[model samples]
Target: MDEPLVRWDWIARNWDNGSPLAIRTLLENHVVMAFAPVLFGLLLALPIGLACARWRLLYQPATAVMNIVYAMPSLALFSILLSVTGLTQTTVIIPLTLFSLAVLIPAVVDGMTSVPDHVRQSAVAMGFRPLRRLLQVELPIATPVVLAGVRVATVASISLVSVGALIGQGGLGALFTDGWQRQFYTPIIVGIALIVLLAVGADLVLIALQRLLTPWSRARRSA
Candidate 1:
């Protein structure tokens, strides 16, 4: 006999199985694994990006290095990290953070460079120090582009977290492996739905954040 495409009973049984494989547990794990690298990468990218923006000479080399890191396969990187971190979340996070940097650094540099020359001159004329101008003027103006990069990095990270299952830390990715091993369809379907939902939901939140942070951009567009 052929099996049905989904089994609601299986989903009910495992929804809160009280084990690591439980849906709730994996969902929580997925959220943490997906978001942590983006947060860390953003924090790290800000200063590096600022430096790259200030020193145009550094931008090419920095981006080149980041592109190389980004080109590395996630599974291969995970294997290499295994010997050091031992099947841990750190192995997954480190690579994702590097990947996030590749996308974010360029975004940040472009965003910073996008600042209008006249606007910067006005800030200087207003007696704003370099640091003060960067914080109060340039950064706010750069928010839209930087947030766009963040959205991309975040969604990519969320998708990549599933690959960690091979190393036993894939969060919701475990469901994929489990479904494959057992030839069960429920977990696989559930996992994919959850991942897609997470990506879309996160993107919406970031868009809202961008609007809130850069009301002037909207006003300019509306004009």
Candidate 2:
């Protein structure tokens, strides 16, 4: 029998009861695997970035290592982790989290550094301790830039999380691979479309969120 040319009509029909299970499965896997690791990276990267920016020695080696991790191909990173952990969720999460560090760290450092030195001096003059200055003053001013970093990291993680399917983590990428094995294109096309949709949707949401979080940014925007 000739292969069916996968089209929107075929996709629309399958999207009903036929593929709802697959969609849900993929979405659940995508959300858990993507968010957990990416969030971990952001949490780690932000503090480290702040510390390094405050103390330059830490920035050199930390930035260098993060850049190395960022440069690593996802497949290569997965293969290395798979050798150590053997095809499990760790193989996905560990590498994805590490991969997010480059974007996250730079974002954090930039945000913290963007706090004018005069502001830092004023906070010191007011007797705010170092940590207090950072928490109450610097970070508040830098929230938008830091959130933008998170936006970038999360978007990147969402796109790359599909690679987890290679280790049986079962994301939308799993559907894409499954379609490839079965010689069906619908699942592959649909999976890619869903990923694109998720990325664009998440970016918009994050942008709105950043705006909401940093009200001072609005004045700057208008100025």
For model 2, what is the error of residue 202's alpha carbon versus the real structure, in angstroms, after optimal superposition? 1.2
Model 2, stretches more than 4 Å misplaced?
1-21, 218-220
Cα lDDT of model 1 by residue, 1-223, tens digit: 4888888998999999899899999998999999999999999999999999999999999999999999999989998989999998899999999999999999999899889999999999999999899999999888899999999999999999999999889999999999999888889999999999999999999988888888878644756
Task: Encode model 2's per-residue lDDT on 138-188: one tens digit a residue.
Answer: 999988888888888889889998988877774788877888998888788
Q: What TM-score, computed on C-alpha atoms, does each candidate reach?
A: 0.96, 0.88
**TM-score, cand. 1 vs. native:** 0.96
What's the true lDDT of residue 57 in model 2?
Answer: 88
User: In model 1, which range of ten residues has the least summed lDDT?
Assistant: 214-223
In model 1, which residue pairs have backbone atoms overlapping below 3 Å? none
Which candidate wins on TM-score?
1
Q: Pick the candidate with the highest lDDT.
A: 1
Model 2 TM-score, all chains together: 0.88
Q: Candidate 2 at 65: error in angstroms? A: 0.8
